[model samples]
Target: MHSKIFRGIQQEDVQVAADALIAEGLRPTIERVRQKIGRGSPNTVSPMLDNWFAGLSKRLGVANASDEQRLQPPEPVQAAAAMLWQAAMQLAKHAAQEEFLQENQKLDMRRAELQNHEAELISRQEAFNARQIALDETLQLARDQLTAMTSRLEEAGILQARRDREIEELRQQLKSREDERDAELQRRNDDATRHADERLRLEARATANEHRWLTELDRERLEVKRVVSAHIELESRAQATQTQLKTAQAALLDRLNQAERSLKDEHHAHELAKMHILELQSSLDVCRLAYAEIIKSQASQEPKNSRRKPLKQLMRGVTVRRKL
Candidate 1:
C-alpha cells in the first residue's frame, strides 16, 4: 500500500503507453496516455508523451533511409500516398482539437477549485488574526494581575517584619522591668533582716541592765532596815542607865547623836538609789517606745512574713518591766 500511494508515472512508463497506443492506431495524446496507464496527471504525461513522439520520428527517418535503396514509387502509388497523407493529417487535426477542448475544460475546473481554496484561506487568515488579538489581550491582563499581586505580597512582608521587630522590643522592655523589680525586692529583704538582728541585740542589752538595777535596789532596802534596828537598840540601853552613872551617861548621849546622824545618811542614800532606779526605768520605756516605732515602720514596708517574733518578744519584756 505504501508503494502504491507514492508511485508516479516515469518517462519510461509514458513511452511504453504511447508506443502501445500507436500499435493500436490511436493518437497518444495526454488524455489517451493517462487513460492507457489508468493513472497520471496531464502535466506529467504531456512532456513525456511529446518526448516519445520526437524519438519515434527519428526512428522512422532511420527506417526510411534504408527504404530509399529499395525503389521509387509509381504515379498511382504516389497519388494514393498523397490522399492517405491528407486523411492522416485530418485525423491528427481532429484528435488535437478534441485533446485541446479536454485540456481547456480541465484548466477551467482547476481554476474554479483554486478560487474556492483562496476564499477558504482568506476566511481562515481573518479568524487566525482575531484569535491572536484576543490571546494578546488575555496575556496582558494576566501580566497586570501578576504585578498587582507581587506588590501586595511585598507590602505584606514589610508589615510582618515591622510587627516582629515591635514585638521583640516589647519583650526586651518587659524583661528589664522584671529584673529591676527582682533586685529591689532582694535589697529590701536584706535590709529588713539586718534591722531585725540589730533590734534583737539592743533588747538583749537593755534587759541585762534592767536586771542589774533591780538587784542593786533590793540590796539598798536591806541596808536601810538594818540601820533602823541598830538605832532602836541603842535608845533602849541609854534609858535603862539614866540615874545610876552620870559620866558614863554623857558618853552614851554622844554616841546616840552619832547613831542618829548615821541613820540620816542611810535615808539620803536610800532616796538617791530610788531616784536612780526611776531614771533607769524611764530610759527603758523610751527605748521600748522607739523600738516599737521602728518595728511599726518596718512592718509597713515589709511583707506579712517578715521577722515579727523578735518584736513580740520585746513588747512582752517591756510589759513585764512596767509591772515590775
Candidate 2:
C-alpha cells in the first residue's frame, strides 16, 4: 500500500526534486529526503527511492525517438535528461557534503589542540606567579632579619660606650685617692714611722684595689668589644644576605617580566589565530554560498535535455567498455 502511493510520484519527478534541493545547498540523504517531503522514517525514503527509479525507468524507456515531440526536444528525451541531470547534481552535493564534513572534523581537532595549548600556558603562568610570591616572602623575611641584626648592633655599641665612660670615671677617682694619700704622707713626716708604715700599707691596699678594679674594667671592656665585634660581624653577614636577597629578587622580577611578556605574546598569537579561524569560517561560508549560487546558475543556464546526454553517453561507454 505504501509503495503504491509513493510510486504515483514517479522517479523522474523525485530526481528533479532532489536536484533542486541539492542546487539549494541541501543534502539529499534519506533523512533529508524524509524531512523535505514532510514525512518520517527510512520507510518513507525507501518509497521515495522506488518512485525515483520508476520515473527514471519511464524516462529512459521513452528516450528513443518515437511518438509526438511536446517541447523543443522530445518529452521522453527531456525527461530522461532531466532525471540524469538531477542524479548528477545529487552526486555532486554528496561529494561536497563529504568534503565539508572532513574539513569540519579537521577544524574541530585543531581547535581542541589550541585549547589544550592555551590551558598549558595558563598553568605555567600560575606556577610562575606562585614562585614569585614565594620569592617575595623570602625576601621580606631576610629584610626583617637584617633590620633586627642592625638594631642589636646599635644597642651593643651604646652599651660598650657606657662601659668605657664608667671605666674612665673610676680611673679619675683612683688618681685623686693616690694624690690625697701622698699629700697625707708628706704632712706626717714629723710623726712616728709606724704610723707612716701603716699609712703606706693602706695606700698600697687602695692602689691594689684600684689596679684590680682597672683590670676588671679592662676585662669588661674587652668582653664588650668582643660582643660588639661579633655583632658587627653578624650585621655584616645580614647586610650581605640582604644584598643577595635583593639580587635574587631582582632576577626573579626580571624572569617574571620576561614570562609576562611571553604570555602577552602568546595571548596575542591566540587572538590572531582566533581571528584567522573566524575569517576562514567566514570565507568557507562565502565559498559555500558561492558554490550553491553557481549550482543554481548552472541549473538555470543549461537546457534540461542538453545537460544529461554527455554524462549518459559517458556512463554507457563505461558499461560497454566493462563488458568488452
Candidate 3:
C-alpha cells in the first residue's frame, strides 16, 4: 500500500536502503528520507535514523541539552551541512504548502455539496407543502358532498314517512265508513222483515173473518125457510097468525144487514193495514239506497286526501314568486 502511495519501491525495500545508508554514518530526518526513498518499515528505519542523529551529533560535538541545535563543523564541513539543510527546508516548505492547498480544495467541494443538498431540501419541502394543500382541499370537497347527500337522504326518509302516515289514515277512515254503512244496512233489513211479518198477520186475520161471515149467512138462510113453512100452516088454520109472520120477517132482514156491515168494516181495516205496510217498505228501500250512495261517495273521496298535485303546484308557484 505504501509502495502504491509513494510509487516505484516497496516499503520494505525503502527501509533496507535507509538502514544501509544510516549504517554508513549518514544522518537524515524521517520526512526528508520519506521524500527521497518513501515511508519504509518503522521497525527498521526509525531506529536507524535515531542512531545516526545521535552519532552525528556526537561527532560534531553538539550539546546534550535539548534546544534548536545546529550542526557545528570544521569550516568546510559547516558550509556543506548548511547548504544541505537549506535545500531540505525549502523542499519541506513546498510539500506543506501543497498539502494545505489540497485540504482547501477538499473543503470547497464539501461546501458546494452542502449547498446543493440544502437547495434540494428546500425544493422537496415546497413540493410536500403544495401536495398537502391539495389534499386538504380535496378532503374538504368530499366532506361537503357527503354532508349534502346525507341531508338529502334524511329529507327523503321524512317524506316517505309522511306519505306512509297519510296512506294509513286514509285506510282507517275508509274502514270506519264501511262499518257505518253495514250498520245502516242491518237496520233497514230488520225494519223490512218486521213490515213483511205484520202484513202477513193482517192478511190471515182478514181471511178468517171472511170465512166466519159465510157460515153465518148459510145459517140465517135455513132459519128463514123454516119460519116461512110454519107461517103457511098458521094461515090455513086461522086468519089471526098474520101479525107474527110479519114480525119474524123483519128480524131476519135486520140480522142479515148487521152481518154485512161487520164484514165491510173488517175489509176496510185490512186495506188500511196493507197500505201502512206498503208505505213502511217504501221508506226502508229509500233509506238503504241512500246508505249505499253514501258508502260509494266516501270510498271515492278517500283516495284524494287533500290533493297532493295541487299542493305541489302551489308550492312551486310560491317558490317561483319568492325567487322573482
The residue-by-residue lDDT of candidate 3 on 1-324, one tens digit each, is: 355445444545555555666677853445445545655543344345444544555567765644534433467765664454344334433443454455456555655655565566556556655655655565565556555655665665565566556545655655575566567557646755777867566667646754764565466455545555554554443333334444544554565455456556655655565565566556556655654554344223211222223434534543443332
Model 1 weakest lDDT span, ten residues long:
298-307
Model 1 TM-score? 0.32
TM value for model 3: 0.35
lDDT of 2 by residue, 211-258 (tens): 876686677657656755665676666567656656765665566566
- Model 1, 165-232: lDDT tens per residue? 65456556545655665675576467557778765666676467557655754664555455445445
Q: What lDDT score belongs to each candidate, Candidate 1 first? A: 0.57, 0.58, 0.51
All candidates' TM-scores?
A: 0.32, 0.43, 0.35
- In candidate 2 the C-alpha lDDT for residue 9 amounts to 39
Off by over 4 Å in 3: 1-79, 194-324
Q: Count the backbone clashes (under 3 Å) in each candidate.
A: 0, 4, 0
Off by over 4 Å in 1: 1-94, 194-324
Which pairs clash in model 1? none
